[model samples]
Target: MADLNSLLDDLAAESAELEALVAPLPPEQWARPTPAAGWTIAHQIGHLTWTDEVATLAATDARTGSTDFTELLTEAAPRIATFVDDAAALAAGAPVPELLQRWQDGRAVLAEALRAVPADAKVAWFGPPMRPGSMATARLMETWAHGQDVADALGIRREPTDRLRAVAHIGVRTRDFAYAVRELPPPADEFRVELTAPSGAQWSWGPADAAQRISGSALDFCLLVTQRRHPDDLALQATGKQAMEWLTIAQAFAGPPGTGREAGVFS
Candidate 1:
């Protein structure tokens, strides 16, 4: 696992890259619809801004030993399924400049709060408690995933970067949660995941001798797990039945099962 400080730096860089992409867009372009149905570029950024605020609360609670975050989780439990979209829709109404600034400011505060968390403490989250490193990784994964929506809306192809390593790591770690959300049994054995990183370095997880395995470019794997692209459009290969099944339902983010992108949409 990466130390919290290094992960935080990467998170900042990833957020900056996405911010630059949207910062120069004219106000009218903010309404361009992304791959996510009914969600425009403004909605994408709005979602990120709202989530960062929630994350800030979690991090603040962890740092100060408070129950503010727990109270939020309790309050939202009944509406968890719709709360994410509801918040995004609400934030989407703000002027584009204001939405952009809120995301920028909220994430900065989240990063600072995360840094102050005690080394051994786990922060309360919608799904589970997370240490600062895990929280940062989750934030990075969401930022990159939402950024994909923004990029696709603008018809821009972003070059794959090493930052995707964080996204991929989350995808791998969330394998079980993906199954759990669907009320399906998780695979009994670990699967080896091997990918060729953009920098030409090899990244692998799980046992080298694991029976089930997935291998491909890190970029495709990230896109697949984030539900940004359908598996049929990617070159990822699965060696076992369960591994293949996982590809069909894999989701890196915490939520209900995502409908996922349509196959061949990007082809």
Candidate 2:
């Protein structure tokens, strides 16, 4: 298993990057629409805050927490759109400043809670119960994805950091999840996933010469999985039919298959 403490640091760094981005913005930007239809930057942060609070609960108390998540999972199975809509609508009601404060506070508590969990322990989540390292990574992935939306809404390009390598790793690790969520079985043959992280370092999964492969900059892979960038607009290349299909439906985070970013929206 990966190091939970390091993963926690990565989560904090990713979260703070978004806070820094949003903190300096004019009040008007908070209400501006993000790439997520009908959701403003405020909603982005607010949703993150809400999820962080729940994740903390799941981390510290997975027994009862998992039961609650199962109920939510059951109810949201057929109508995930309604679940998402309701969550965001409720989150959007809070004022932006307060939401940001809540996010910071929530994450602080989450960091502590995660570190206190036994390394072998699993925690409840929207998709699956995960161990400490994975739980922290999931939080990191969500913060980065929503931060992308905030960056898009502000018309700013955030410089990629080494911290983003964590998100890229999650995207690669979730290849089967991308298919599973769509009710498609994973391909029979494994595919190599090779990415150049933001630090300009190489990262990989599967065999080096799997014949079936996807290769690209880490940023593109992360954007694709987060549904923050359309494949048509990214520099990614796929060699296998399964790899190609996976790219089209990649979603690293737990959610209903997201309607990926509209082509040319972020171009």
Best by lDDT: 1
lDDT (tens digit, per residue) of candidate 1 on 135-219? 9999999999999999888889998889889999999999999999999999999999999999999999999999999999999
Q: Summarize candidate 2's per-residue lDDT along 1-267 as a digit string, tens digits.
A: 258888888888888888899988777778889989889888888789878887887776853344665565677789766776677768778776777778789999999988887878888777767887898988899999999999988888999887777787788778888888889898877789888877789888888879889998988888988889999999999997888888898889996677887899777
Global CA lDDT computed for model 1:
0.92
Off by over 4 Å in 2: 63-80
Q: How many clashes in each candidate?
A: 0, 0
RMSD after Cα superposition, model 2: 2.1
lDDT of 1 at 204: 96
| Whole-model lDDT values for every prediction | 0.92, 0.83
Q: Which 10 consecutive positions of candidate 1 have the poorest summed lDDT? A: 123-132
Lowest lDDT block of 10, candidate 2: 63-72
Off by over 4 Å in 1: none
